[model samples]
Target: MPELYSMQFLLFLAAVLICYYAAEKLFPRFQWVILLCASLFFYTWAGLPYVVFLLAVSAACYRASHIFAEPGVSAENKKRVMVGVLLLHFLILGLFKYTGLFRRWSGWVIPLGLSYYTFQSVSYLLDTYNGKQEAAGSFWKYLLFLSWFPQLLQGPINRFGAMAPQFFRSRKFDSRLFRKGLMRYGYGVLKKYAVANMLAATVSHIFTQVDGDISGCVVVFGILVYSFQQYTDFSGGIDMVMGVSELFGIEMSENFRQPYFAVSLADFWRRWHISLGAWMKDYVFYPLALSKPMRKWTQHLRRKFGMQWSRSLPAGAANIAVFFLVGLWHGADLHFLVWGLFNGLVIAVSDCMAPLYRKVNLPKKGAGIRLFRTLRTFIIVNIGWYFDAITDVRDSFICLRNTFTRFRASAFAGDILIYQIPYRRENYMIAAVALLIVFVVSLLQERGVDVREGLLKKPAVLRLCLYLFCALLVLMAFPFAAEAGGFMYANF
Candidate 1:
């Protein structure tokens, strides 16, 4: 089985870092060359056949963009060029990644990372056509951006306008940068092994073993634990990626903030998977909002129900459609579509009720108000996450029904404990402790405390001890085998 921290992978990263730092110090102009070579090596390490496909796609888009950018190109011609490039990329993506759906047409194994980089490449082509950014003069720089090792498999889905400038900026290997990067990486390791992994084991055990005979209360507990497991697993992977990028003085986008603290579904989307949300807003919502049909509809609504109703209905409908698309993008499955639509509906319903909510005049400042809002937000977010965790629409419906069934003493009985398949008393204890730590840390961060900085301010011995403890936990707890599990967003 493949391992997350294989010795060969570590050796590869070490060699790349050494060469990268050396190149930065010696021939700064050739740093892009070093990055390109390292990226190719990284991609090849996944599989040599896949590397050929990656290069071919990169070369095709790079050349197509140049054609679109030529002098005196008519507006219609430019549009055609842009559309052609995008379609070609999508076609290649479908050929490799979606071949299973069309197995009779073409039998081919989908390459890893193709879904991620395909979107990145299409975004690059679109941005260049829209005049948001210039096409890279060299193919190598474009290639490096597409296959950057830290973001290849799982992505924050970067755009050229945001990431290209940093790729060109020369980086110097400094002690401060190294220290900060290592700390971030270490923090991610602790979050994954010490917290997320343990929760995963427990959730897996409960979900698999809970029979139809289980009582409502025990099922609710299992669902709650599953919610936390998914959150930490996905967010912990983001931390690892972000931390590794920092090591080379390259910063990727931040994907999550304090999402669970959000008071509304709209606010939750703003804080969670921020990159995907931003992409949908820019590419889908804005265009639809400004389209002629929507504008006419807005005018018609204004005539029928005064100005206020007219102003919101058009944009509100657009948001719902965009979020529906957002869900479909995660997978071809109907369950994912329902999950996305559920969020979109929540946002829509909340918007409709805003005037009533405002009239209720809830206090906004005191500790009591803050505590109430925090708890309310946590409950709502967890319910949404529960829908996301279930296997299908029917299962989600049954789970919800079971949750609301009448409580009973037998629901919490010892037999319920026996039904937890792979779970142990030790696993539960460890997961509970890990969750407490996560909650405390999140609370500190939500209050605007910089956790790493605060830790640094402690006495040297204390700080060292904390660091060592985190390292030991990771080494002891990480599931090292490939069969263990993968980052949640990888399937997307």
Candidate 2:
């Protein structure tokens, strides 16, 4: 399979674009055919067998949704079909993605985008069942929605209602939109290859350090770098995917919003992986929160304790359940489970302490308060990255122990730290400069500035120079053979 960041994928994308636009001009009515074909080719090129799985999912979902919209189907039967379709979708997802948790072989290769597309399938069925939208006009259009190539691998998790119409609508070529797409694509390239790939070298080495060989400062610094690597890679991939969609005049959901600037754990999640959060809230959290069992439980709490515990307890319990499923969705591993629970616990504790925070009466508008909140959130988030960075669940505890007990200033010195990193001093300089650039851009964005639009207004030559500099930095930071790997979340 060709890596998405590789030159080969670029060549493939170029070919697809030429064919796509030409088809749009000559056979306008069949534009969707071109898109469906391109999407299938892209998926098949990655893994031929997975294409069958993709089709099966799309077919099942389309049929189930169609059944729901049938004129004479009884409401009870429609509900049964909805529930059955959801279970079948989830069962396939679990078989492929969670076999590691259930069996000993542990060598099954999960299908790409199974989690993403399955969620999309669930949404399609539920929306049809609830009358949010009619059943798709045709299976082909529904299939195209499930298999759109750009966001297929790692997603903003496109919605059927929002995206399906865009796929079939007639669009003329627009120079401004194309230019914006190019710029977004360039920015994603810089973030992925220049910043995240470079940081991965140091972060990987530090996490692999054995017991008695690590320092407190090293652990903290390593986890900090891991946090940066994760955000850059995931957000960068989304940028590229969304940029391609923009070129086609399709606007994908925004996935990241400068999460590190967020003031609390809940706020951090809202900013990070916004689509997944939205999905869980709509499909998992809200439904569970309002379900009969949960309502009954809340009422019981109110009777046993009081209104205070009643309100917070039920919501907190629902949050724990949502995040546990969230973690399991990432992978059926103990580390991921712990990562999910850790986040849920933090959010629950914050809820319980909300009254105390209100009583403190901290100034809400001051820079000092904002800075303190940002740092507090950042620290908490970095601590959670330990579980994510370590695949062996037991190693996480040892890593945390070293982070607190083995303090050493030497970890900051050139010889000690640089020796552990796979990259050279010069590469570190490149990463540092790239990070500074991203930090400045993120700061402007946090304040509601459109950095891309600002760049569009700059002199042509200045913009060209900046683009060239970023491309060069990415080239310089390209990983060696031993360090090469795909995006972190590709496993999901």
Candidate 3:
């Protein structure tokens, strides 16, 4: 299969653009036919076998949607239909996806984007059942929505209602939008090839030394670099995906913000994977938090301990439950479960301690305090990364121990040399420079600056010079691995 950044995929994207616009000009009303064909082809390019699963999921969801929309359907029947379809969906997903425990025995090739599409289909069903929107009228259009190529590998998990018009309607190509799309694609390339891949080499080298006599500074450096590697790779993939969707004038829910600047674990999650978090908020968190049992618990607490405890404790419990599922959503591994619980416990404790925080007065609104919180959250997040990036639970703790106890910063250079990590000063310089660029851009964005839009407002000569420089930097990361690697989130 072609990686997103591969030359073959680029050529494929170019051909799609040419054909898509030509189709729009000629058969405008049916331009979507070309898109549907392209999506089908792109998906099958991954593997022909994967198409069977995609078709099955699409068909099941399509049929279920119609059943749900039927007039005079009783409440009990609607619920049965929902539960039956969901059970089947979860069964299929679990068999293929949650096979980490039995991966040696299981030969299931879980379809790409199974979780994304399944969650999206569930959202559609729930929305229809709750009268959020009517069920989609056309099966082909619905299938297109589910199988749209850009987000098929990783996704923002779109809604049918928001996307129906974009999928089915006729539209003209906009040169401006296309240019912006290309620019966004360039940014993604710079992030992945230039920075993330470079960092990946060092991170891999450091983690592989966990069993060796690596020092605390080396482990700390490895985990910190891993954090940036993960963010850039995942967010860069999303950027490229969004850029491609822009060529077709389809907008998805934005997946990330500047998560590193987050002031708390809760705030970090809110910024990172914004769509999945939104999904949990709507489907899991709200439902659990507002459930009858929680309501009764709240009443009991209110009568015994008063208002503050009543409000915060239930929400904290809901947070822990939601994050437990979030961790399980990643995989069936013990490490992932522990990672989720760590986050859940932090958020739960913070929530439950809100009243005490209010009682302790300081310069809460000061810039220094804000920076402190951001750095503190960042450190906490990096600690969590040990569980996530390192697979073995014991190794994760060992790395944690080494991070604090075995403090020798001088071993960093020797470890880097011993690992033969990229073995080039120029490579390290290039990656460092690229990261500096990212930091400046992110800082501006944190202050509400639209860096891309600002660049667009510059004079033609200035914009040309900047674009050329950025493109050259990307080219320097050349001889990029052709196998479609670096997207860390694709596994999920």
Per-candidate RMSD, Å: 2.6, 2.2, 2.1
Better of 1 and 2 by lDDT: 2
Model 2 worst lDDT run, 10 consecutive residues: 411-420
lDDT of 2 at 459: 99
Cα misplacement distance, residue 476 of candidate 3 (Å): 1.7
Superposed on all Cα atoms, model 1 deviates from the true structure by an RMSD in Å of 2.6
Candidate 3 lDDT tens digits, 235-279: 888888988898888887788889999999999999999989999
| Candidate 2: segments with Cα more than 4 A from true spot | 100-108, 411-419, 479-482
Compute the lDDT of residue 83 as modeled in candidate 3.
85
Query: Candidate 1: which pairs clash?
Result: none
Clashing pairs in 2: none
Task: Give the alpha carbon lDDT tens digit for every residue of 113-202 in model 2.
Answer: 778888888888888888987889899999889888887878877789898778887667788888899888878877887778877878
lDDT of each: 0.73, 0.83, 0.83
Error of 2 at 400 (Å): 2.1
Tell me how far the alpha carbon of residue 456 in candidate 3 is from the true structure, in angstroms, after superposition: 1.5
